[model samples]
Target chain A: MSWRDGIVLSLRSVVRRPARTALTIAAVALGTGLLVALASIAVIAETRVIAQLGKGGPATAITVDANVVDPAQIDSDTPRLGTAKPINAETLRSVKQLPHVSTVTTVQSQDVYVLPPPIGSALSGYTGDDPDRGLARPYSDSAIGIDFKQANNLPITVLAGRLPAEGSTSEVAVTLGYFDHVHLDPNKPAAVLGQVIEIGSPQVSPDGQTIRGRWSRGVIIGVVAQDLGSGGLVTSSTLTNAQRAWQLAGGDGNSFGLPLPASTYSSLVVVADSLDTIHTVRSEITALGFATTAPEHLIASVQRYLQVVDMVLGAIGVIALLIAALGITNALLAAVRERRREIGVLKAIGAHDRDVLRWFLVEALICGVSGGLIGTAFGIATIAVVSHIVNDYLVSQGLLGVDLGGAPVATSLIGVAGAAVLALIAAAWPALRAARLPAREAVGAL
Target chain B: MLGSDAVARGVAVSVRGLQHEYGRGRHAVPVLRGLDFDIEAGSHVALQGPSGAGKSTLLSLLGGLEPIREGEIWIGETRLRGLRRGELAEYRSRVIGFVFQHFGLLDVLTARENVMLALSLAGIPLQQRMRRADEILDDVGLTDRAGHRPQQLSGGEQQRVAIARALSSRPHLLLADEPTGNLDEESAERVLDVLERLRVDNGCTLVVVTHNPMVAARATHRLHLREGRLAPELVGEPA
Candidate 1:
């Protein structure tokens, strides 16, 4: 018979028995939905973990710290000598010109913020700034002076306002904890945008005994999604140190040519051209007498863990689909038996055995495709619900540099198509059984 | 090579030393024993036999449904003995069509769809299949009942639908096991009349396996089967 007639006839046969067909379709759909959910979970976990690691540094970028020689290590009984030397300008210039080093962001200088209601509110009027707020414990954390040229390496999600503008000395994006300590909703970072805060900026001299700079006022412009832990604050890159702090803050407009040297940098963020060469870049930086920090190894471990999870989810989903495929086999087999006389009549009218077989296979295929589509939609809904629970937990745990929200659920089209193909494969046995039945016995008897 | 006029009058069916048996070993029961015959093209021939006389078995072999165990059967230029299993099916689709005694209509299909399905099996295109099907249904006097499924149609109507499907493809041969076997007097007469009209109009070979003397009387020639061997054909007035 013509393929067109075969398909139409198959459709008619399937539609003639609605209850049985629907039952089979529902079974297939259930299995497909489970598969989709599992695949989606694997995708979400891998994406979030990668994003979290990127916050420390881009997966391909390595931050190198200058090595300092301590006198105590040389002479154990000589007591203490001093701290290590920071990476110098010559070393910074050397690493920047390395092969395959696409771009560089020099992280020069670190600042301290006297976080109000600090670690523990003791109501002790230590600063006498807000005496009524006694236990106004002061919070202290390292604020990395960010250079906007390399901001792409940071996995920061802006929750409220924009990031500290490229050249705006007055704008600074602080961590959510800055507002959290004052009992305001830190989640609503936008509310604090343009608000002024008195920052206690105490700088230790080279002798490490003297302090400089009094309380400096800075305005909040952006609120990031995740806390940089030690509550990351990206100060305006234009104002890197106390020397240029006043001028860049738009107060004096002077000292525009002063360069912040790498000697005072907490650490430098160096971006490589590709992830595969991150190890080479790290080793190159180490040869320059500096310790390198890269998240590539940690990310690799997470990827391996996610692979196992995806396999398990895939296994479970496949098991469900196999069971559904069996349902199709059972349903189609019974249908073939019931339509024995019809098969005979068709053969008598000139239907080839292949046509009879194709009709059954096509019927099973229809059931599979319809079920897979419904299951995929069901899986998307499932991801929506599961992600809601997950994102809430991530928020409550104060996780660093990971916001699992905003990314849509990942639906694997191939997974759904696989379910359909598997169902057809399962139906092959019954279709062959129907085809091999003697047309004489099936029709001539009737 | 036969001329066009000779090919037109070429033997429609030729059976030589045809032998068939059932079961095996000690349980073997021989059916047709050394049966031989030649049927001219465009002729109505009826085979009449009592119950268990192997009339249906002979028709089955003629339609290529089964292989002749010890003899050769030729239908026009094609030999049925050497044909592959798939080739047999193709031969049946292109050259042979059957109308069963029990009115073997697919109950799920309407009277019209049954005819259209036959056209489809004949590899007719979709656009013209329905129109041809409707014409055949109209020929079998089932135009008003085209949409009525087999269950909804009466026994006479179902038989007519089957006849319509058997003739819809306009095959080279029409095999009717019992065109009027399951009908009342009036219905049987009407079906027989329709069969004769379609056979004459289409000019295809007609072979009927029947038990009724009246059906045999309507044929141009009648052969009686007794104990697996055909008796002499009783020739009627020449068409």
Candidate 2:
């Protein structure tokens, strides 16, 4: 008999036995729905994390920390604090010469107050003499230090006037946030160019390890783009003079109660020529006793973790499906036994054993497909309800991520197909038994 | 083995020294002890026997449903003993049709579907099945009851449906076992009438296992099975 005939025969049987078919479908649906729901959650989680990590920062930008050792632990050599080798001019020089290191700039912070702090300024609501107190300063907010001679090392884009010319120690640049700190309109960065500004002395330590000096003056020759993190104090080409002025203002190595072996950078921002070179460059920098971090690297780590969880969850779903397949086997074997006479009639009427097998397998196939579709719809609906509950919870808790929908169609389809294939496998033995049924006994069976 | 006489005038079904047993090893019980028999082509033959006399076994052997463990069963020029399982199935589907005593109709299928299924099993093309099924249903006077399932039809009508299914493919050999045993007297006569008339019209050989004398009376020839051996055949005109 043709497979179509077999399928039609199988369909008639399915229609005849509604309760049995419904129970089989329900078993399959339970497994498939569980799988789809778990898979959708995984998809949403992955999408959320990836989107979060993909911010304005490009993946090619690697931030190199001065310390490789974990800061959360204290070493015996430093009784009270964790310590690691610092990034200095020597290491910076070596990094700049590395292959594919397109650009590298060291950022340093300045803790100084503008004399007669401007009114309604960052110095607002504070009366403390200690610079480290809640009292805020203009340059304290945007640590300014860059090698203005190199285009790649410019801490900020020159918004008006110009960056300091090479070897020009008297000229300085400030960020838009510095203007905000001084209570000046941020839009007026250009108006302050060429105006002389005095930086007050930083507070000295009680241990006499630091010495306070008189205020230092520099001409603001340039304004840089961005709200913060542009150079607020000095230029790298004129490093010694700037350091001498900062030291005179009591901003020496021992000023902040932390002993520095030498002048150290706060951090280094390294830019690779392209995405392909970023990893190698980061690894090379890390080998030099510095911690390396990049947006793409963090994303890769999260993805690795998420993949394991997805596999684990998917495996649980598969186990459920396997159990469902067992149900199929049980139901179909019973069918074969109960329908022995029917089988006999078919054979007596000239039906081949293979035709009998095909009919039973077609019945199983129907259950698998119908159950899979219903389960998928159920899963999508479950995801919707789950998303609503979860998103509502998140909103109440004031967390990121808006609405969670989009249940990866391709993965769901593959899962449904897999379940159906498994059902076919489960039905094979029963189908074979039916197909090999003897016409003699089957025809005579009551 | 067949005698030299089989070449002289061929028979529709020829059996010689056939031996069949059931179970296996210690539990194996012999059912049909050496039996030899023949039925003419285009004739209706009734196989009358006591219960457990191996009448159905003999019919199954002749129709190639069971393997010939000892002797030979020949349908036309083909030997049933040496045929492979697949070949035997083909032989049964193409060369022979069977009607069981219980009116072995698929309960899930309608009367027309039952007959159509038989035609399908006989390897009829898909396009001709509907017309062929309708023709067979009409022949059995089941045209109005074609849409009724086995449970919905009376025993007489169900038996006619089974008979229609057996004849639908027009197999060269028809082997029926107690086809009308479950039906009443009136239904039994109608079933016998259809079998006998279709037997001559289709020109296919027919052999039936039956306990009813009335069933045996409709056959052109008669044979009795006693103690797993066939009695001498009796010649008669179907009445």
Candidate 3:
């Protein structure tokens, strides 16, 4: 018969026994739905984590450091030193003029002690300025003195207030942690936008006498934005102002300027032309005798963990699908036994064995596809619900400082396809058996 | 009384020293022994026998649905015993049509669609099937019942649908196994009438297996099966 006729006949055959058809479909749907659900969630989790890791990281920037290094490696042994040699500013100017070298930000870091807690909670040394507060620190990881004009070029997302003006010597944009520590209300404009933080020197001079250093000036030009992450801060201030204060305290103030001969940054941060440039730029930087840090590595580790999670979850989903498949096969086998007479009748009236085969397959396919579609939605809903709980927990813990990750569309599609393929595979044997029975004998069987 | 116009122009079917047995070894049941017969190009014949006399088995052999244990069956020069299942299926689709006692219509299909299936398997083009199916159903006096599934129709209507299906592809031979056995007297009469009409209109060679004397009486030739062998053939007028 023509394909249309075969399909129509198969459809009618299914309709004739509604109860049987429904049971079969339900079995397939359960399997397909469960599979889709797990797969979709896994996909979403992967995409979210990857996106968070900077899937769209920089492409073509070079990183220069004190030593030759593999940019991709995160040295567990090396300490996160507060003080590091700055990449020479003069070299940076020369590098900027290099073809394909678009932009560069010289990063200088030094360990600084700040009391954390309420601004005035404990005068016990520096309570609120606890260095262990992680990214919740009220200052940069190491105190970084930047030329406010050029420092704005660093990849800092200012949450509240505007960028410090290029020539503004008094203004500063603190990391989100500093903003939180300052207890600046986000609803209102940065009330501390133009306020100053006084930096006092504590060390004595080489002359062996306590030196009264002039307090450094800093304007609260910007507040750090909250991201769903644990810790880290990015802040900027005028290099000249910071240098002058350090010099007044008999410290190395010119370290903020062009580094001395043979000097290179202990750590370098480079910006790519676009999101696609992230990896390439990171690599190029690493190739330039500098170590590099990519959120991708962190993201990759998270993804590996998530992949295991998904595999376990997906296995559970597959088990459900397996059960559903068995159910369909069992149901169909039962129907085959019951409908021996019906099969015989069709065969007698010019229905080929293949026609019978097609009928059973069509039934199973319907069950699978429907279940897959429904299950995809089910999976997405599940992720959404769980994500909501995660988001709530984060908010409650006040830990929504950096984004962890999210679900995407590709994951759902994979889930649905996987479910469908499984269902079809499950139904194959039963359909064939039903088709190959001897017409006369099967009819007589009834 | 076999008419040239009733059969296709070639030797339609021949059976020689045919033997058939069921099961094997200790459980073997021999159904036919040295059975021999030749049906010409155009003829309507009836096989009459008591239950277990192997009437159905003989029909199965002739229809190429079963293989003879010994001897040979030739339908239009193709040997039934040597053909593979796929070849047999192709052969059945192109060369033979069948009607069973119980009407054997798929309950899910409307009368017309049941016939359409036969046409489809015969490889008729899609555009031609609808009109062709409708014509056959109308010819069987099932025009009004074309939209009704088998379950919705009476036994006679179902039989008529089966007959329509058998004739839809215009096969050279029509095989009926107790075609009217499941019907009431009136319904059986209607079915038999339809079969007779089909023979005249389509000029098809017809072979029917039945125990009913009335059915045998209606055939141009009557062959009796007793212990799996045909009795001397009897020629008769339409009952």
Candidate 4:
């Protein structure tokens, strides 16, 4: 028979038995939908995790510390005096001129005492009283200073307002950890923006027994996620101005009697041209007598873990499809049994065994393709609803939300093709049984 | 009894020492035992016998539905014994049409689709199959019921639709096994009339197997079987 005739016959047969066909199609759809949904979810999860990691800083960024000459001790943020050569203006210029080195930002930090707004102020309602201090009191904190012109290199997620203005010495951005330390509600961090706080530089008394504060007023412009440095972030000039003011007030040195270096920075953040150049740039920085650390190694470990998760989810989807294929085999076998007489009539009318096989196979193909299309649509809808709910929760928790845009086109096509091939395999035995049936016995003529 | 024009337009059947059996190795039951016969092209013949007399078995062998176990049967220039399974299927499509006693109609199809199925199996294209199906249905007096399914038609109409399906391909031979077995007297007469008219119009050989004498009486020649062989007295007799 012609292919058109086979298609028409198969379609009629499928439509004639509504309940069985519907049940079979529904089984296939559920299986395929689960497969697509799980696969898409895995892809979205991998992308979101990588994006979250990226929020800290570009994977190519390397933190260079002066006291850490060994790469093994790269993570130490504090400077150890007399260990390695300190990074200064010369160090910054030398690192910037290295191959693949895109830019460099100087970092410095100082201990400061912060005094929150008093009761009945704009932020007083959102701030809780410390058990040791009645309402508002000075608390010891650290302010990390970096070049605001190269601020993009910082690993920070701003939760409210903008970063401290490039050249504004009076502006500062506090970390979420600082809000928690100061008894401020991190969940409502926007309330703290625009509030003024007093920052004091520590100085030793002439009697050599007590410490006094050299205070300056600054405005809280933004709240950011915790990163490599703690407390608040400011322009390098801001911390330098505070330190110079303390020195001009007859303070000979810090509480430890160590002189502050006038020309050198505590550390330097070096940005590479791309992730491909991070390792080379880091090695060059380390060769310059400084320790370097980047996030590439951590990213690689995370990727390996996500790949395993993807494989597990894919296995579960394939298992579900196989079960659905079994359902298809069962349904087609029943159809062959019920249509024995019809098959006999067709053979009597000169239909070949191949013709019979083609008709039934066509029926199976229709079911598979229909189920695949429907299941793909169902999977996309499921992802939409799930991402919406998850994003809502993420936003409420004061974090960046995830965007999971349906499965990729290639993934969806593979899923549909997989369903179709499995269905064809499932229908093979039943179609063969129908094709090989003896015409005489099938028509009950003998 | 055959004319030269009918001989030119139809296929003649010759059977020599034909034999067919069911089962094997002592459980064997021979159905057609050394039967010999010749049928002229364009002539209508009837095979009448009691139940289990191998009437339907002989018809199936003639229609190429079963392989010849030990026999030589020829239709036109084609030998049934030498033909392979695929060739026999082609022979059935190109040379013969069949009508069963139960009015073998696929219930899912309309009357027109049922007729078109025969044309389709013959590898006819869709447009021509549709046109030829309509023509044959009209010839069988089923044009008005073309859209109705088998369950919707009466027994007489269903049998007529079967006849239309058989003739839709315009084959050289037509075989019917008890074409009127399930019909009332009037419906049987009507079905027989449509069968005879379409057979003459298509100029094809017609063979009918029936237990009813009324059906046998309508044929130009009759062959009566007893105990798997043609009865001597009724062999080659005119009805």
**Residue B94 alpha-carbon offset, candidate 3, angstroms:** 2.0
Q: What is the interface RMSD of each candidate, in Å?
A: 1.9, 1.9, 3.0, 1.9
Off by over 4 Å in 2: A51-297, A392-398, A402-404, B1-8, B232-239
Q: Is candidate 1 or candidate 4 better by DockQ?
A: 4
Per-residue lDDT of model 4, residues A1-446, tens digit only: 98877898999999999899888888788888888888888877776446432432433357776664754554433223236667777888889899977777777766677777653235544434654544675677677776666666665556788778776778888877667645766787787788778777777655455667777677888876634455564545566556645744544455555344443666777777665576788778777887766776776677788899999999999899988899899999999988888888888888899999998899998888788778777877787887888766765565654555677676688768877887799899999999997666434632
Model 2 TM-score, 2 decimals = 0.67
DockQ of each: 0.47, 0.40, 0.31, 0.52
Q: What's the CA error at residue B156 for candidate 2, in Å?
A: 1.6
- C-alpha lDDT (0 to 100) for residue A14 of candidate 4: 94
Q: How much is the lDDT of residue A184 in candidate 4?
A: 66
> Between candidates 3 and 4, which one is better according to TM-score?
4
Runs of candidate 3 exceeding 4 Å displacement: A43-47, A56-307, A345-355, A391-416, A442-446, B1-11, B231-239
lDDT for A423 in candidate 3 is 61
Candidate No. with top lDDT: 4
Candidates' TM-scores?
0.76, 0.67, 0.71, 0.80
**Which order, best to worst by DockQ?**
4, 1, 2, 3
Worst 10 residues of 3 chain B by lDDT: B1-10
Per-residue CA lDDT of model 4 for B1-239, tens digit only, reads: 22233336553887778898999989999888989887888889999889888888888888888889897778776778877767877888888898888889988889999988888889888899999999988898889999999999999999999999988898888999889988999999999999999899999989999888898988988988887999989887987
